[model samples]
Target: MTTYSTGGEAVVEALKTHGLTTVFGLPGVQNDWLYNAFYDARDRFRVIHTRHEQGAGYMALGHTLATGKPSVCNVVPGPGALNAGAALATAYGLNAKMLFLTGQIPQKMIGREMGTLHEVPDQPGTLRSLTKHYDRITHPAEAGAKIAAAVRAMNTGRPRPAALEVPMDVLQQRAPIPAQAPVSEPEEEPVDAEGIDRAVSVLAGARRPMIFVANGAQDVPEEVTRLAELLQAPVVGYRTGRGIVDSRHPLSCFLPEARPLWDETDVIIALGASARSALQGWGKGGRSLIRIDVDNTVHGRYGQPEVAITGRLESHLPLFIAELEKKGIRGEDLAEVMPAIHADWKERSSVLDQQIRYLAVIREALGEDGIFVDELTQIGFASRILLPVHRPRTFLSTGYMGTLGYGFPTALGAKVAKPDTRVLSVTGDGGFMFAATELATAVQHGIGLVTVLFNNSQYGNVQQMQRDLYGGKVIATDLQNPDFERFVTSFGAHYGRASSPEELAPRLEEAFESGLPAVVEVVVGDMISVDRFR
Candidate 1:
């Protein structure tokens, strides 16, 4: 710990209370006081420096998601926070829990005539818009209570995220330490028996049912599987819940297929999910939506439920299963609906399999220890179609906030976070290029990640629409290749491009075997063409 001062001690104490092991971000003058605080507490805490603030925020996010616990990030204000805004937005968008810490210029000099040095007008105000909870420490004396409020907020009603900002001067002052722990994490309400019965009644009554989950509920696949078995509902994750269960599971009907689903379905239950519009199926007047989530913010108006139960997913689900069994809602038979859905999906899967054999070959060659990272484009759908994600934590994707450029940085973080695993970034050409510059960060940092850039060249999703609706005329759907493999070589990361499935498989094999940073570019054509195109 390179820190000092009573305020600094307060921050350290707060982190210790939270059991935070690592802090990701570079030390800067603005954050000097906080760094000094860390220096002082170095024996109990450790800091992991990142090259970019975005990377640091993302690294902390990856750590939080992987470990299922909150992670800490220390960033300087201005560009540091701005650069990290995307990751913060992602955290909010994903319902991920984290603490974003930033050091401020002295509070007295906040908005003065001399331009406040590195201060950018409204610092905490700017952050407050994106975060669920954020506040600045006005005085050293208020540190304990403020930090406790932030921590308590993280455990309460709806945990988007919390931010605690301390000014340089504020961090240097001596403050009274609280004797007792500030805030305790809130406990979930036990799954109510009445609520369970109500949920099952709705499910049992529905002729056509669909379960759209948003979070990675698959961590307890058996429980989820049990529920699905009881209802015989077609299970699918709108976006975040993509790989909750094996997409290839015979019982589940949804994948990242392009065509519309849930159209014929009359009932939808959203559990531990952020019930977005896309998944809800707009204008479906008759479809009833049943939601169960720990976060109360998911429901509108107030923390009320619409045929819902509120609590942690892990704890509540088993009880739900027990209740369903107790009520004698034994088995469901959607035999007719199941066959048609299966046939429609199978037809599409067969067509897709013919084209993307490369993804499977690559997975096989990389072996069981391989780790897969997915981007938002067809890379996500394609991987779902081509690869078999057999185990948990072996695969990671932005299920909540599916964004581009998330792949490379997240892969690097995952690699560094779990060095023993073989990490692979499966992303579209456009998405891959978003953080392509980070290849230098990867190589320079000496982290080895195998990047499989799905080179459809243009924004694959947009091109597919144009190809289907228009006459396949290449409008904005074209790219000037920069010899990606060689282009990234300057960054000390190896590259290999493949135009065919045969070519991609061998290249991925060699790259994974090398135990170094490498890129394998695969031209899979417009995979969406498979989605919309006959």
Candidate 2:
């Protein structure tokens, strides 16, 4: 056999086997090996050029979140790897299963103390403190297996980002092994019958049973909804479980205000919830708690466990529901609460309804099954309250990282991943333009991702915060723009504009059905937040 492939080739081959088709990266001197690997492997995956290394890292993370696949990003050693720190940290909180491949200065030259060109005194050790896993390969041939192992760890277990460092020389050297199949996540691991029975016992006896679902609930979204129905539990989603239960649903009460929670609160049933990790430890001291994911290592807020079920969320939740049913612990048939919940939802919907003249028309025109992936802050305000997406994953918002500028690119990526989904990105004017170039990519891919620009003419959140905390003089926050819809349309795409409620509906409808990468700019009124959520 010819000995041509090197360590870098092995890593690229492993990534291809895992089904990654596109990788974002910036090349540098120390990364010549992987850079060459990327070019040679161009047939399997395309390299997306990024202006900034950090942007490339986040783009990969965003792709992972949108597709539920490990996205790869290549970075050279030292500053290049350091540039990815912030983005990696954000994805870490979001539970990103991304594979970040970086190159290291050759091992021999690393510590010559010559203060080499790309010297990072202790790159792996430094990054290890910030990341979930960081693997450095000293051998060329083992690159495939080691990289696969890192990906396996990242995809399963706690589900976070993993990094690998390939030495420049080794990447050019011949590898001893060939690429292999990645280790697959197990078929299933159900919730323990004993734990579920115990949890059911607690809920059945309680006069007031409340359910608090967190970001982790998305793993078993159907089970989450079913459990809420089974228990007549007033369902509330944590910041991460935004799309699991329809915000429009009477049971999804964690919106605008924490009213449903304060009224008649008693036992809080947490399924796939991490009190500490989810940052919901507050207000739980007085309330009794029953947690499903019993992995204490998952969070610091692991309180005195009343009931702990150890299993995968998809399996555990179903088993938990089965056990509850067997225990004859039927959810309280509080039709009375349903009516109250419905009344509350109707009132909130009406408030949103009043504000819909500007957006509702466009939303309707887009059609019911239209997919809306939201930016972090805007989506929280608009989509959850305005857009009205009832499907899980259809409304992709930041549950953990809450990163901005994720709007444009993520919509582009999601549209590509789920080609059948009618993808739209609803974004603030400032946020939309951040990764606006992805528009070209979307067009190139032939995916018509509709873009809605919330033209508040400023960094709305910061300006709003200023108004809330300070006297709202609006310093350095407002952003200037040119009929951005026109700007995008000039790039050979459909576009529209709406400044008043009268124009919003018609323009939105027209734009959605137009069938191209379109943008509709909506100039929002100075409507101070009509409602707030904790």
Candidate 3:
């Protein structure tokens, strides 16, 4: 049956049909009709009005990461779309599932060069560069199908960001609404038999094997743990792959101490992990390698692999474990070696007393279920090894993008998605300022989040780099921060300050338990260089 409906109503109906319950965005002139439709349907949808387009987009990204469900971000044309681009890039880098809904100039004015409000030379092209797919709704009738297609793109193989642009005229125009078919996602392909056999044979012959799990392998945490146990190999997770195996497991190793084991291992199993700089190009070669990933292009990009298995980790891991068990291959117990590794790490931490102590406090406060949103900072990198993440998706970072202002907004998104779970965002003073305005959004929405701002009164990362590389000359690295306590209190939120390491734990505990948006500013010294580790 066909029914008369405005393009705005069609878009709203499409989103609702596709199971979009929450949307984050700001209102603007070009997108007024769409916003009206959302407002009319307010009872059915929860709209979170953010202070900026960037925060809205990031909140959408954070929501997806915490719930493993696709999220939506709506924005106006031109400037609004541009403002949201940063968060879109972050989502793309992390391979997160997000749908960006943008308003465009009327169809007639699209390429007229008539100086329309919020007009860009080629808006679709601009959005295409940031998302996996970009499409336009030329007519009101096409809104449902196009929105469905965008949602499908976000949910399909190797999930990524997608955008849909609707012209202002089309949104306001009336057209007959057609009944739309339900969105159906394509099934993932099964693991190849030959690839599975090769992986089994390689593992069967290996003596000292190591499994490196990446974010791509997040879905198969139990299988990864089983495989690690069966192979008796040390398991190491990098980036998004952090909690693939319980970090507390005796065989589960931290990245800092796992380097020595990498040198001794005869075979390496790289699962859903990219060979980024952090892994030092997958470490000095010469080891038998088995690489598993859904993306085929990632294979042999860094290190030559003996076998490349292309499929979802959830599907391939169980098969690999079954084959290994059939062959009677079991991993050696490393109960004795774990303690020595811990001792070495403790000795190394003696020089970073304050940083270590602050991290210890955060770890104790967050416990196992708390979500930690990390920004690029000295302490951020340190927590990768010092903190123990027992569950998947509990630790969120900017991934390969290394975005600085991402922590606070992303934490807000996570809290919105998982309200029952406690969320904390740890950021450097310089990075926190990028999204500091989000404090209002947090307080307004009652999104209780604990932000631990490490204030060294400078851009510590670059400051240290300049000292090491440029004759100890520091340029453009110093920062003058506000009184953090008063600043947070002005927004009707709780605030705490820790001038020294001893005050960190109690202050953080108080702020986190305050049941409001809070900030804990911990005064710290300049970052120590990696040369200290050597």
> Best TM-score goes to which candidate?
3
For model 2, the superposed segments whose C-alpha errors exceed 4 Å read 1-4, 111-121, 187-191, 246-250, 254-258, 275-282, 298-305, 348-370, 376-380, 385-387, 443-447, 482-486, 489-493, 509-516
lDDT of 1 by residue, 428-476 (tens): 7777776677676677667788888877677877777777778786587
Candidate 3 lDDT tens digits, 433-491: 98898999999999999999989899998988888889899999999999888889999
Rank order (by lDDT, best first):
3, 1, 2
Report the Cα lDDT for residue 274, model 1: 51
Q: Model 1, residue 261: displacement in angstroms?
A: 7.9
lDDT for residue 271 in candidate 3, whole number 0-100:
86
| Ranking of models by TM-score | 3, 2, 1
Name the better of 1 and 2 by lDDT.
1
Per candidate, the number of residue pairs that clash is 14, 7, 4
- List per-prediction Cα lDDT, in the order shown: 0.70, 0.69, 0.85
Q: What are the TM-scores, per candidate, against the unseen true structure? A: 0.84, 0.87, 0.96
Write candidate 2's Cα lDDT for 424-505 as tens digits.
7778878877777666655655667777777878888788878887987779987888777667866777788877767766
